[model samples]
Target: MEITAKVPETSLKIKQKAIVIGGSIAGLLIARVLTDYFDQVTIVERDRFPDEPQPRSGVPQSHQLHVLLTQGYRTLNQLFPGLEEELASWDVYTLNWTADLKWLLPGGWSPHFPSELKTQSCSRNLLEFLIRKRLAAYSNLEFKETTIVTGLLLNPNRTAVEGVKLRHSNGTETQLTAQFIVDASGRNSQTPQWLKSLGYEPPQETIVNAFLGYSTRWYEYAGNEPLDYKALYLMPRAPHQSRGGVLYRVEGNRWIIGLIGVGKDYPPTDEVGFLEFARSLRNSEVYEAIKNAQPISPIYGYRRTENRLRHYEGLSRFPNNFVVVGDAVCVFNPVYGQGMTVAGLAALLLDQCFKQHTKSNSNPDLKNLGKQFQKKLALANKVPWLMATGEDLRWFTTEGEQPSVMTRFLQWYIEQVIFLASDQAEVYQAFMEVIHMTKPSTVFFRPSILLSVMRRMLSRHHKS
Candidate 1:
């Protein structure tokens, strides 16, 4: 499937131009969506994008493992048709969640069976490269590489954003005006400071840090041993278990192994300590699988795994014709693998908002669209925020806001669900769906699942 340049109907094209900050996955997807509503869309990236599929300086974590959840995969395919085929052509591994993943839960190993949750495994570099390549086909889309956004260009009243101030790599400064602007600049976004500089109050922020750290190393496939699963995950149980690991087969028949530690027990980057950390996981599968594999890259350590949400929607005053998306608005702990999927969902929501805005008004401008989109994006971000922070708060050493009574109750209930998932395929499938964002977390509260949880609790109670 090929995505052709979208020629928006004259009546629907409400904006003459739009600007997107950053050129990561979120920015790229947002720019793609903007092409439908704006005559021209430009992406300003701080780093000079590489010519091929390789790690760049801008995305420090690009070398780590990236899982494109089912919803993310579907959304990407919707945005850029034939994305899956293109990934397959690059030898990316495609596997069903349940059938191809060997997951070690807190209780035991989860049951493996065929299910609908199918997705691809690859390094972040490759995925971004393919998406950017697809995006290049649009004639109206433009990329300003090695350019940084200095600040927002606002109207005299400071109630609306007119464009952005740019600083090119050549030390030249210029301003690019647009009808609409979006900030998708990831976690290090300077939107808060920019707002402050404009004499506007920044959004309130909530931080939930588990102090989790991980080290990743790339490896070449060397073993001829047959395995039932293509990927392996050893999840850390809260309070006591602070170590975990994951081994995934990515493109080019290579494996990306990540060793995780919580509560400030940072994974070591040294050769000996990396393997030792893997050996400390709850299960030996990840360690056993990679102990003999030929390592191809040095161990890379990353520690910034906090879940942060800047409540932009709650702000009393926000500039019109401007909005925040992706990590700039809400960033999740990467351990949950929700970042990319949530960004994809945000882009889709932006598309829907544009359609609705154009359909309702005969001559629409981006007057109140930013506020509307921010509120809706906040609501959309709630579930994943809870999912990531809920898990992070389970650790006793976690900082920031403490869990509420409802959160504690849900955590306890979810632990039971995790136990049941080890043996019950139905429960596991539903759990996978919720985790993959295909269904709401409310699915766990449905009558059927609730009854199962009660029965399991009662059985365990009687046994105790």
Candidate 2:
């Protein structure tokens, strides 16, 4: 393996151990961050990574389509400089969010225009492959693959995490000691249960399920036809129509077609049913794009689409030196395409907390580290959680807490804004910015956007 950068061992020396569970994107990133503060960072992964970009047992959704939002794209570059260029070398496509993509909103088709929100388009497998490869550069990092983390090891008083109990594939169990344990496990994480086993109360969970399900197929683009855009999204309308689909360019001149259904409407995995479901989408773009395309892979189905927030920050009593990140903390509805980006942000937050702790004291007290990081992570997750859950609530069949008056009002306002965005380029740009996480939600409340929304709402009301 090629060494990325040789760090002077004496420059950043600390006699500490940090263990990160799960070697997915989030875990790898956490390991990267820990290297600066810890003497050794071990990432325990359930599956050995593939030599190249391919699916693995741990990440079931590795075959699915994924895009890095503008913020995530930028953050990744900051973490691993020239990452975008490296992906390009591997044939990952970077498409303009608005100009090179077509969107079919409930109101109408979104107007095409140039915007700063450029999206990094590629398969989840390819992205993970690149991240893992980059992680190989750190001399202080180590990965113990094909190992399962059974539980956490706590101190004598059970006040702080001491390490983790690991079970090897050969059925042998052992303990690895660490000053800090970071859980980057995905949606099926067992952190809550592990915490409860140690006599600590588990974080309360908030689930909003739209019963969303999807079927995806990989296709090789037949160079015979000319394409109008690099990607396309046909959104599902709530209450009445619940079918949506997206077809986008990935690596190797191939495209991924995923058809989504909400409220228990599931896309079929069989070929005949899959094509029929794609054809039945509100817009014909996705179906048309894939109808004559060559399918390189079989249809795969995924159904765990609930937006689950494990409210770790709300827990009054929590163990020190143990913190959760990534989907282990919050799993959003995947159709919103926020998982990777949110994970990236959480890793950034963890890095900040570590830097702040190191700067303030020569020997920082690590007992309260977990609680402080959890609270900060919760604040970081607030906006994305609201955006995802609010949209999920639009469907009446969604299960979870009832929408508050404030939520309902904001939802109404956002729906109007979406309508205005469909026609106006400026409004669409602002909307894209908010969704891309580069701008705050308050951008939608700007005077220009608000006036247009009111004008459109009143005009429609008068017409009706």
Candidate 3:
């Protein structure tokens, strides 16, 4: 989608207003896009945002290691120009994923070469703070913090959402009306219950859980170590080696190390067990790098890693003038680092849908906009959802629908691609591109890659 496209003059003349629930990265991005098309945009957040780049009570995963994939970084730069420079001023490290990362795959170490897949390494707190700062500069935007959205306010026919009923921190209740409303609330969204209360059938849900968990700790970086790579990733081989870890260098001269475990082998919050978990990874690079690092923060544990998709698009009837985005509609396992990037893509999609609506209709109407957007958004989220769930299903402990034949074949093909990536720079770059969402999975289907994969498979088959 052309995110920088100019909003039609007709759109600006309309007295339209938009309200976004939750002040998350997705909500902030949606509000930024709505500012261009709507006369007013208000963000309703349950928690008061922090003045500085610090974790707030609303986002529990703020202290963990967060990665902005290549596409996500580019999308942010597009939305907020000079974002990279601003992050650089804050000491956020921008590194090429291929060259600056030491990634140990299931087979072995992946090949490292200079590539265009560069990403920002920073804490979630800092990224959200910077995005919110940028959004504050817009005159058409406003933030309603320390307020809870109690329920949806529907019109007389109850076919469209006219507004939201909000309860302030002081227990005062009020209704805020808007032409359009979006729910960007994270995994704990209550939109389903609200819809059911209004006599609407809730969307069907699909959940794939691997029972994965991770514990993270921050270490002060003195810049005296002889590390060649800027980041380290040790992936756990499924079904056997179920432990992994990552050491990411973020802003403020600090390293956020996350020790991960799958299949209900949750990482412990205590320091001793955290280190022991890291020490048990398939590779010791993460452990060795942080073994003697100066610790700066307590070990924080998180266990709600699951791939969930609320099939909002499949709903036969949805409220008009209302839509859902981000974790409210679908949430993926964070281990693949697809959440922020997918959210960015969804924001861009929202912008595109609005632009198209304005062009197609003489008097742009949002009567069925929610349904249209949800349908397109479901198509957009398919690849990432499949990618995350496919990987999780490799473990026997994962609970979800059984993998189909095509899914199993794709799994085997991807394993071959990863095995080839261990020794082939070209294959590694292609895999990284797909993983970063810069290229489609068809990249692996090219003649050269196909030949290499087939030859390797055939050779191993003959030997067996």
Candidate 4:
């Protein structure tokens, strides 16, 4: 990893440093954004980053099936140009989501057609690896592997974060002072406790757990000929079937099969149980794809699928120069595949806020910067959070507050959208655009789309 030119410290008049905890995707993207403002950006991680595209200890779900939505894909391209081509060099496959994926929605099978909703298909390890590799081109960015961030160092008034105290794997402890600190440490972040210890109240939390769990296995699948699509999604129908599965094409001519069960009925990791769970899915496509494929790894099971949101934006008091992003603030149900995309949007928002803050002040005074950004991030999270929670609430076993009347109406309309998408290419494209986060949810309410939905509904009703 080499950079064309080094940004010398002498050229930086501000002499500010930004420290980001965790070297995962969120942290890496934050570091990338900070390089434009801060003179130095250091990333602290508890686990050493592997040199190759392989899973590390810190990211437990790296081995699972991960999809980069359209919005995230575009963001990565904007942040690191030519990344898609580079990923292709690594054998990463690119496919149009609607055209290439065979999705079995609750209404019916989604119609296959070409659309602008293209995505990259590969393991999370490869995606992280490419992002980290791209970061090496920035002279101001640094990574401190095997270093755990213990807590934050605050100002004399305890109202602003100065830096972070960290402990290395060798048992050595030190404090690095930074003008800004960001916590992107995933779902197990200790920010809440750290804030409470600093005499500040923790943000209100909302948890909506569906008791969703999944088991995944990788295989060297040489599929039988006549394979038309690159991916298969067997979605679970609520109130009737609680089992679902997906088969995705990954690098190295491999396929990753994931079996999902909701309502505390988790898929098992044992060989027989794994196959049995696949066979029990809503459809036979997942089982058929992996029935004869040679599995290359043991089944990995994960169960932390709850949708959690911390209302940090609503807090009356919060320290300046410190902000939380990614799963630390909001963790979505993985079944929706919205986590990475939301994190990407947050990073982009961080960049935007910095620009706004600088334009308003001459010396980049960050007064209320953390609070303002958190509020905006919360707004950015509105759609995805509602979408995930609304879908999760469909199951009677899901534990959460009842949906509002408006929410129920929207859900019903979305169901109609899904049913129309089964055969109508226009409706399918609009729906996919929204789900991919490239367009607003209001697209479903467009006059043309609503008319299509109404016609489809009336036709079905008359036939019945």
lDDT by candidate, in order shown: 0.89, 0.87, 0.89, 0.88
TM-score, cand. 1? 0.97
Q: Write the per-residue lDDT of candidate 4 for residues 6-99, one digit (tens) a residue.
A: 4544334445899999999889888888887888899999998999999888999997989889999998888777788888887878889998
TM-score of each: 0.97, 0.97, 0.97, 0.96
On residues 15-74, what C-alpha lDDT tens digit does candidate 2 reach at each position?
A: 688999999988877777788778788999989889999999899988777777888887
Residue pairs in candidate 2 whose N, alpha carbon or C atoms collide under 3 angstroms: none
Give residue 306's lDDT in candidate 2 (0 to 100): 94
Q: What lDDT, from 0 to 1, does candidate 3 have?
A: 0.89
- Total residue pair clashes for candidate 3: 0
Clashes of each: 0, 0, 0, 0
Write candidate 3's Cα lDDT for 15-113 as tens digits.
678999999999999988898788888999999999999998888988888888999999999988878888888877779899999899877887878
Candidate 3 ranges beyond 4 A from true positions = 1-13, 360-362
Clashing pairs in 4: none
For candidate 4, which ten residues in a row score worst on lDDT?
1-10
Instruction: Tell me how far the alpha carbon of residue 113 in candidate 3 is from the true structure, in angstroms, after superposition.
Output: 1.1
Residue lDDT tens for model 1, 45-92: 999999988998888988787878889988998998778888888887
Runs with alpha carbons beyond 4 Å of true place in candidate 2: 1-3, 6-13
Which portions of model 4 miss their true places by more than 4 Å?
1-14, 360-362, 456-464
